[model samples]
Structures are given as structure tokens and as C-alpha cells.
Target: MQQATPLQARVEGGGTPTMANWSLGSEAGVLKDVLLGPPEGFRWMGLENAAWSSLVRDTLRRGYSFDKQLAMRQHREMVSAYEDAGVTCHFLPLDEYNPYQVYARDSSFMTPYGAVICQMANPRRRGEYAACLRFYLERGIPIYDMVSSGNFEGGDFNIIGEKTALVGYTDHRSEEIAARQVAGWMKDEGWEIRFAPIDQFYVHIDLMVCMLNERCAAVCLETTEDDIVDWLKARQIEIIPASFKETMALGCNVVALGNDRVLSTAGAKDLNTKLRAAGFTVYDPDMTMFTWAGGGVHCMCQPLNREAA
Candidate 1:
């Protein structure tokens, strides 16, 4: 596995890449550079009252307290885990206004062409992508394009392999029009897009399916459509089914660090045990506090550079 050059090192060695142009061809590629949302910005600002998902409201109603200091510590450990895997981790600038910005994966996605800025579904998250745009511009990373159709979130875009992406649509977060528009862009880029219709209970495609390695995926079969499963099978992707109980525990929301390694929460024992049995090195970090804000490991990091397998 090859470690990708850090953005700073890339700039210093190659003299600032072209503005708005970046390259990320595969999700299971050797991860070199990544963007981890800053946990320092995690704050409870009463936005839960107006949360788009009843699940989030329910979590809030349960009197779940999110500790900012603890979250920061947990994020540090996760970053350390990435470092141990030879991944270069970058972070988003803190935005006190957008507390949920810590889920960096929802703001933008990296493609072979460049970064595609997403149009957020929630009003509270509308400006988070702008911060990512700023980082790309300042660091000389190219911006491939921006989503203009209805509402789109990066969480719905799941890159499975080279030249392929699994895009999802949930009425609460991503619209079919938005998915179609993304599919069009991918088609123009000479890539295939598998449009997956998601259940309302889940937030994104990543929430139900995560690529774990070159040929394996951690999938929540209950919410995954049969056609989507067939598509994965057609591509020879091995499915590691996670039960509904494990899915609610965010077991499917794992992050692949290239090789046969995955990062997940310590609470995801069933999925972790299965992944380990499948020869994957699982790194479980305690991120229970982060989930209280309504997401898991996969939601916190965005891959900036992946060496195509």
C-alpha cells in the first residue's frame, strides 16, 4: 500500500496544484491524504430541536449529553489511528456557527477530476461545504464542480471502486433529482453510478453500505435494495451483512483505511468481530459522544487522495 502525499507536501514539492482540480479515483485505494472534521467545533447549540430526523430528536430527547472535551480527545485518538496507518490527516477550519460541520463527509466529496461541493439538505448545514471549498482553494486543490440540483449531501455518495460510485436518495436528505444530476456528472466523467434508494430511517448510502477493502463491503441488508446488492455482486464485491441491531449501533458506518483495515466505534462489536474474522484489522475508537450528534466514523472523514488499486 502507498501513502498519498500530504497536501502541504504536495504543494511544496509540486508548486501548488491547479486551483479547483483534485484526484480521487477509488474509495478502497491506498489512502494518502484525508480531511477529518475538527471536533473542536462540536457544540450543542439547540439545533436539535429543529433537526430534520426524528432519530436525532429522539437521541436529544433521551437527554444524551455530548462532551466537547471528550469528543476532541476521541477525535485525536482516531487521527492517531489514521497516522498509524500512514495516512495524512488534515482538518476543517472551526465554524462555531455550524456545529455539525464535524461530519466532514457530508460537505464535499473528492473525485478523480476534483472536489464536488455538495448542496446541503439542512439549512443549518448549508455553509459547511463553503469551508471545504475554501480549504481546497487555499491549498490549491481543484474544485471539480458543485451540485446545483435540489438538495445533495456527500453522505449519499459512496465510492465503491475505480470509476464507480453508489449514490443514494432519501427523501429526508437527498432527492432523486439530486441523485440523477450526480449520476449525470459521473457518466460524463466516464464512471458508473449505482442509484440506491434508501429507507427513510437511514441517512445516506454510507450509513448502510461502506466499502471495507478492494472487494469487500460492510452492508446493512435490511435497508439495502436488492438491485444494489445485485450490482455489488456483478462487480464481485463481497458483502459482509450487518444485522439491524448492529446497524442501529452504527456498525455499518465504518471507514476503510486502505489495505484490509477499518475504523469503527468500540460499541460495534458484532460487526468488528465479523470484520476481524474476515481478515480485516479493525481499530475501534470510542466515538459514542460523536454519534449522539447523529453520525458515526464514516461521517467524520473525507478522503482527499486515494491511490487507485
Candidate 2:
């Protein structure tokens, strides 16, 4: 019989052991497996949670209608794109109460050592963690630790490269105290952590910045702080600027499939063109149903096993 993976794999005094089966050192790696949320129960959070995000607020303000069929179709297209890119897709068990569970990247994120289960800020979405916990436990994936300091979502945790991370927090969704707590844990694991403090309106740091490869990143200069830009440059990373207009549309929020390929949205025409011009194979899928609800390709899925960069 095979030994079962522990629920918590993090070491008490630091130096947590890395995963031998699942390897992911950076966001730019070639993805092998990905975790995606189910779209079956998705619905607009409605006026009750309009203040949840600017995008959702705008969607309501525009009187946009919710089409479950269209949303599911878009999700299938997205999954097809990933499959075409040679990625295996894993879906979280459907939960009727957690409509926003479609945004899988928000509940938990993966790390070199294991997966970190996050504490969600929104009361309606807190139950999302239960699904995440069950998925990891069933798959034999180690749980590094759970966030208890404060509310901190997975989107705020950005892995730039091996042993380097950029942790972000908006006092609203992700608190500074929580970000510091996560940073401290990674620091003990010998990681260089950079703190990114941004406005709550932007939601998460990934809205304006995402690494395309080890040597390149797509960023929205207007929304991203100067210090963050300088930090990326300091590491000798080439910048691909996405217009603020596009970034607000969730265009800048993209997924790197490694091997000079990227998964972006059709609305992100400018960035897609630029990426293709830069010698990248870009998969442009129409995801208006999700993007208008406040997430994009990057926000909908979480990479599980990735080839080391």
C-alpha cells in the first residue's frame, strides 16, 4: 500500500520539504496539470455584492444579463484551449452555495512545498475553502498551511521565479498582516519576498502584472507602481506593457503556457498582437461571461504541476 500525503507538510522550524511528485518553481513553467473551478452553479453575485469588485459593479451598472449557457460554453472553450496546450484539467467538486467558485485561483494557490489554503475575505465565499481542502486531500497533494492571520486570497500570491515571490495585499480583500504572515513563511523557506500594496479597486496584483516567462512579463504600467516596475527591471525582465483600458478588461491577466505560448482573451487584442509579434503562440478565447464578472483566464485556473524553469 502507498503512504498517504499529510494534510500539513510545512516544517515547524522552516525548511519544508519540496514536493517530489508535483513540481512548480515558477509561473513561467510549462504547465502539466491545472485546477479549475466548476461553472455549473455560477451566477451574478447581484446587487448584494456589487461592491465586491469594480468589474462586477460596472457589469451591473451596464445592466448586463447573465447567461448560464453562454458562461458554460465559454468555460468549455477555455478548457479546450488548455487541453490544446497539452494541459490536464482538474475541476473542483461543484458547490451550490459557492457560485464564485468558478474563480479557482482565489481559494488556494500552489507552492513548491505544497498548497496553501487561503482565508477568503468575503463571507459568501468563505465556504469555497472546504472544496479546496477536499480536492487537495483527495489528490494526495500536501497542504503547506492555512492562512489564519487574516483574509488573504490566492490571487495575491504571485510566484515570479524559483525561490522568489511577489506577495500582494489590498487592505480590503487581502490584508497587510496576512500578506506579511505568508511572506514570513516563504522567507523562512529561503524565498525572497517582495510586498506589493495596491488599491482595493484593482482587486489583486495580478490585475496589472503577470510573468510571461522567466525573462519577460506583461504589465500595466499605469496601474502598477513604479517600484514594482523597477523591481522587475532590476531582475533583468523585459516588460510588455498592456494598456490600462485592456488591463481593466482583464486583458493583462494572462496565463503563460511556457514554450513561448500564452493563454489570453479575445478582448485583449492589443496584447495578443504584441505577444504574437514577440514570437509567442497566443490562444485567444472569448471569455466575456467570466471577465465581466471580474476574472479572466488567469483567475479561472490554478497551475498544479509545472515543469521547472
In terms of lDDT, the best-performing candidate is 2
What's the CA error at residue 164 for candidate 1, in Å?
A: 1.1
Clashing pairs in 2: none
Judged by whole-model lDDT over C-alpha atoms, candidate 2 comes out at: 0.92
- Could you tell me the lDDT of residue 172 within candidate 1? 70
TM-score of each: 0.90, 0.98
> Model 1: how far is 190 from its true place, Å?
1.4
- lDDT of candidate 2 over 225-295, digit per residue (tens): 99999999999999999999999999999999999899999999999999999999999989999999999
Give the poorly placed runs of model 2, Cα more than 4 Å off.
Answer: 1-4
Candidate 1 C-alpha lDDT tens digits along 1-309:
744323332221223333333457777877888897777778755554335654476576788876778888888988998999999999888888888888899888777666778888888789897789778777766666678888888889998988789989886788899888878877765678888887667878888899998899999888788889989989999999998876776678998888888888887888899999999998999887777667788888889887666
Where does candidate 1 have its weakest 10-residue lDDT segment? 7-16
- Give the lDDT of residue 193 in candidate 2: 94
In the order shown, the candidates' Cα RMSDs to the true structure are 5.8, 1.0
